[model samples]
Target: MKGFRFGSTQGAFYILPGHGGWEATYGNETLGEFSSPQQAADEVARGLTCPHLSEVDTSTLEIPEKLSDWEIVHV
Candidate 1:
């Protein structure tokens, strides 16, 4: 399973596509809107001691299947 997972080692705090424009979030709480997903992920990495949660952006990651549910259905 591959996907973009955000937040610290505590748990998934946010998602990228949902926020867009490199917005970082924790649940409904918007942590901060970064210029890029990498930046947002970096900030999280600095905050947390975990490396897995730090890497973000074009970097290889698995896209969660659940996100498909939120995708816009093109007619």
Candidate 2:
């Protein structure tokens, strides 16, 4: 699975693969993982408490279209 990075320098946001689907990581630690991008975004929106966060910036990683729906398992 592909990922995206959001937020600012104080603590950037990350969306990656988790056991069930995708995961969100902030700074150097993981916040949570979910089954879809919307789910992951919701988790970050509800959970993040970063002080320097004014807005979340999101950029999609280059991933093959064929593998877009594949589940990413954290190893």
Candidate 3:
């Protein structure tokens, strides 16, 4: 289960199914607990710039390191 990757500073994150909720993690480090996977992903993505977010079953998401210099579209 891979997560979004935005350059080196923005490390990998994941949303895993837990007992009553989902767990958001950065590598082996647990970031927080959420009620749903979408919430987890949104939370993580909120902390970074133009993160290439993906689902748990999806492949690793990659974004150009120079994303900060490019214009990003939000929707």
Candidate 4:
């Protein structure tokens, strides 16, 4: 349940999981999936030109103990 923020390859920017696996969100939100953590990170980086991507500290985010109970739809 790692979190990384980046821009989209085409348009929008997003905060997504760093691992290429199942991602869960709060309030039954359906976040997308990725083939790998790097892929996901790359997607984030593509859309955003934010310096925060390079400077922001992502180590403080707390991983969830379990998958979200809300419905999850594939991205």
By TM-score: ranked, best first: 2, 3, 1, 4
Q: What local distance difference test score does each model get? A: 0.46, 0.54, 0.48, 0.35
Candidate 3 RMSD computed on C-alpha atoms after optimal superposition onto the true structure:
11.7
lDDT of 4 by residue, 1-75 (tens): 444333223222333453547332222333445665454444333332234334332222232222231123334
lDDT of 3 by residue, 10-72 (tens): 454456666688766655666678887666666655553232333332222342323242232
Better of 1 and 4 by TM-score: 1
Quote the lDDT for 52 in model 4. Answer: 37
Query: Comparing 1 and 4 by lDDT, which wins?
Result: 1
Query: Considering only N, C-alpha and C atoms within 3 Å, which residue pairs clash in candidate 3?
Result: none
Worst 10 residues of 2 by lDDT: 58-67
Among the numbered candidates, top TM-score falls to 2
Q: Can you rank all candidates by lDDT, best first?
A: 2, 3, 1, 4
TM-score for all models, in order of appearance: 0.46, 0.53, 0.48, 0.28
Q: Where does candidate 4 stray beyond 4 Å? A: 1-31, 48-75
Give lDDT tens digits, candidate 2, residues 31-70.
Answer: 6667876677665655554333444332232222222333
Shift of residue 7 alpha carbon in model 2, Å: 2.5
